[model samples]
Target: MVCCSLENNDVGWFSRRQSAYQCTTPITASQSCGGLLARIRPTILQIPPIHAPSFMALRRDTLVEAVEFPIHLESIERYFTMTDRRECAFCASEITEINDSKEHVIPNSIGGRKKVRGFICITCNSSFGQSWDAKLAEQLNWFSLAVGIEREQGSCPAKIVHTVDGTELRLRADGTMTRKEPFFQKTESDGKVNIRMLASTKREAQQRLKGIKKEHPGFDLEGELKNLERTAFKVNSALQHRLELGGSEAGRSVVKTAIAQCVRLGIAAHRCEIGIYTLKTPTDDRGFALFYIRDVVIDRPQTDLFHLVSIRGDSEKGTLLAYVEYFGAMRVMVNLSSKFEGDSFISVYAFNPQSREELNLSVNWDIPATELHAAFNGFGLDANNFYLACRNATAIAYHMQKMRERHHVHREELSAVLSQLGIPPGGIPEPKDRDQFNSLMEEKLGSLSEFIKKIPPMPDD
Candidate 1:
């Protein structure tokens, strides 16, 4: 049997028996009670406090992910070099003040390893970090909670508001959840679960009822008491759905992060806004807002995390396209150029589920750019003709074959969509001539304006 004692001799910092105790540090012992014959005064016993260095030895009681407190960049010194390029990558404004602040090509809060020197000035960096970057972290943090993905945050507990029994309760804890003044506690002995309420006393409960009655004046105290008594021993309960009280910040950050990579790669500042994936199906399409990129970029991290910034281009595909896709996770590919404003050159490219690599510049696979310009009210281009004007027919046929298989989409559906596209169905006809496909596709696209003109003309009412 193990036993211990808090003897009076070990009560003070200056006590003779203090050395007998394993605890150190100054402790002010409470005043001692006199002898039994003397006044009845209590002596306070001081327990040894566990210092910070010993925290690791304690066992955790709960399992949860670690998340950092939102990162705050204060008066951090501006550092990092800039390219000879004089324009800010984001706003496309002139970067006159070059030496004031440094920019992290990837955000630093969520463990961004790489840094970019300049091209994005300090003011812009700080602004984006506070607004856009903060938004990204919150989205990530919520994702962490929703999926139970553990995050790392030193030794402090992360504050998360989660739903409990359809009610929102804020949980603050590390891997070991801790709560103060819990109204009830639970214990499992046999196969069943149990909840033990900690009501102080019958009188105390009555006082609470009386207080409620006094506050509301019209409350039915007796009826409430009867209901409480009826449910006093009830134990079964079920958890319904959870309603997250958060804002949407996933898709935009993917674009922002990708843009940062473009800025780093020496893409002209104004050209950063080359294309934007349609925001119509933002969340389902873009990412778990791309938290997994962190996993791909870093060593084993706390979750499927972060986004990648891949910016590349070739001359054959005349129009730029930007879109994001999701399967097990989400990734984005975009044309990191702003050629839309100067000349009309645009195309819409779908993210291929099989195409894991970032830059797949298929000259034959593209959509008309004027479509998006019309959709986004112009800030776009038209690239279908530019690419068709330089397409390789065999390669086009091969690319279409791959797309058809990868999507498990029927060839009929493909033909139907292409028919609407006004491109010749002959372009994708039965496998015969190696060189005839491009001509057929061109023949179809050539009569596009005439076909548009010959259509029913909206039928004069």
Candidate 2:
């Protein structure tokens, strides 16, 4: 266990047991939390008093991920007295301010918000993003969109889905779909030209018309615009989506995330020798990632759709293992290193991908080191557990779909109320009539209690 308390010095200092470690030196107050935290040792550093939430959390929980806390400091001694943590984990090059960058344990595109700095240099970080993280994001973006996950960076990539009748559609991040291509038909009979064009949107139709006008120079653009009609069709056909996981690219990414979590848990990245080697050398072998369902079960809180990561180190067994799960459907166990000779440690992080909110939870699996290795090597695989996980994922998706439908219905009802009040679709009432508008809206929309009862409360934090 680690414990730290603040000192009354000009610069904040923390003492761990018998030893004292200077976590921060006097620096400019204007520096951001990320920039300030990056200058410290990569090891676990207690958050300052100012960040009460994180500081209090740290006192009660030892396994929580480190939170950023800004402190006033000048450019004094930045290196930790224990070890120089500025060395890159992959390349072992000295990390300078110019080369340092924050690396997310989970890819940001897939709704990961936690990040660590000074663990890997910018070069290795960029390379991993382009290769490992990119492939993983591509493989998981469909589920991300379906879950309506909140991303730390750009929005999740849209997926190309197909209907049962073989119609191609672009599935957007918000659970909406549009035709991949515009539909156009032209007919000329009895010296009269007839043209029919249909598209998912008016803009799409107009763009297609531009191309058509080139072929038919005598076409009337104004008449066509006046005749344009907006159509909404309900698609009853089921959607078909394909997901393939555990490729070399995605395998590397899983391993990378495991190693990153280990680093965040106070294990130096250099100590993760096997993980570094596996990431650096690319191969077609998918054994690095194995579907894992805990043989020893413990009841965990129900989380609809969450991303989970856990790392365990057993010095006696001389093994370090990590587990990564995306959307609670695909679970993977990775053997990080077999030469681990550090103290036994375990850390878990579980959060709802949709809200990007961390959950107060823990995960436990009682598989022995030998059995885990055997499983990783393709021995004694459990097909039943994998199937169960997939089924559960499908159920969660269906639940989310139903919730979205309810919200859509609510929006339509609200729109109807606005129309009744002589308000435009997106316009609000004037300031003078605001009170009346509120009263009318409440009277028409019914009680808020009914809506709350219809939508279940989220899982406990």
Q: Which candidate is the best by lDDT?
A: 2
Give Cα-based local distance difference scores for all models.
0.31, 0.56
RMSD in Å for all candidates: 33.1, 20.2
- Candidate 2 per-residue lDDT over residues 1-461, each given as its tens digit: 01111111111111111222322222111111211111111122233333222211222222222322121011111011125466787789988888976788888878888887667889888876458788888877767776777676567776776654565776556554456765567789999777766575556767776777788889877666544542223344434445555667777888878877776766677666667777777763432655543522245444477788877666566666777888765677776666666567667788887777897666665664344444454432344444335434644653464365345435655664666567889888889778877886676355322433333233232
Tens digits of per-residue lDDT for model 1 on 1-461? 00111111111001010012222221121211111011111122222332222112322221111212121111011111234456655444566644524455444443344455445666656665446556555533322322232223331234333222332222221111112222445466886444333232334445566666786677677765433320011111111111111123444444555555544554444454332322222333311121211112212111122234433343433333334322212333343342322223222222221222232222222333322222132111122211111111112222222233222213323443445444476464445542464564455343232222221111111
Model 2 regions more than 4 Å off: 1-82, 188-195, 202-238, 284-287, 293-297, 301-303, 405-425, 429-461
Which number leads on TM-score? 2
Q: Give TM-scores for every candidate, taking all chains together and pairing residue i with residue i.
A: 0.34, 0.67
